[model samples]
Target: DDMTDPVADSARSLLDGHVVLSRKLAELGHYPAVDPLASVSRLMNSVVSKEHLLASQRFKAIYATYQGAEDMINIGALAPGANRRIDRAVSLIDRVNEFLLQPIGQRCEFQQTVKWLLDITKSWDFLLPAEQDLPPEVPAGPNEADA
Candidate 1:
């Protein structure tokens, strides 16, 4: 009973923090409005939720794989397939910061912190190799097909 108690408590805490943070982020503005803090806050909640689910082993193997992918993104671990997702997430956050936070109008200090967090995430050493230079697969010749 004691063993499960801590897990349950931790899960509860993460969930509570996620919910509170989500609500606070939502109160700032509407979606697609390019609010960096709001976007980063939402992403952070998603990362925490996925991590909690992975830790609890509550999902199917496929779901766990997806969670692992998200974890790589959240933690900025480099791997072959995970880079695109991580890059996309970082790019979105970056755009939000550039468009919304960098301007003089309607500034928020929280937005600056979010940008810093994003920079740290993007700078992680686990980044995957660039995909642009991958060697193209040659078509199998007619004789090669028989082998």
Candidate 2:
């Protein structure tokens, strides 16, 4: 989530970095640039609930799988043996791509983010647009913006 912050954050700020999303989302091309590898969150065990934490882990795993599949595809090695996995990976990547279809200034709530993430993990086939896929919008909730 940090776009290379220079400020010497306090211990609270350091640990509060429960969610470090990859600003390199290809889905954000409605603007420019993205970095997919640097994304994962779950540091605030003291504040966030357990269920959501677990969901976050699942979300991380999915992103990891997508990255792996992308690597394979780039190398032209995603062939017969890893066929299904490759399909799932590309599908997951596309799903995340679909997620970037949001309007400007609007933010997804923590519950809504978790909901989309859970839905993302449960089924690779189900693709939702940013508007319909997301839960109801809320005030500035527990979330960080990406590129």
- Cα lDDT tens digits for candidate 1, 20-108: 12333346553323422212133444555453433222212222233446566666575554344444444444433343333336556
Candidate lDDT (C-alpha), each: 0.41, 0.55
* Candidate 2 C-alpha RMSD relative to the actual structure: 17.5
The CA lDDT at 61 in model 2 is: 56
Instruction: Output the lDDT of residue 113, model 2.
Output: 79
What shift in Å separates residue 82 of candidate 2 from its native position after superposition? Answer: 1.6
What is the TM-score of candidate 2? 0.53
**Model 1, position 134: C-alpha lDDT score:** 47
CA error at residue 38 for candidate 1, angstroms? 27
Global Cα RMSD, each model:
13.9, 17.5
Among the numbered candidates, top lDDT falls to 2
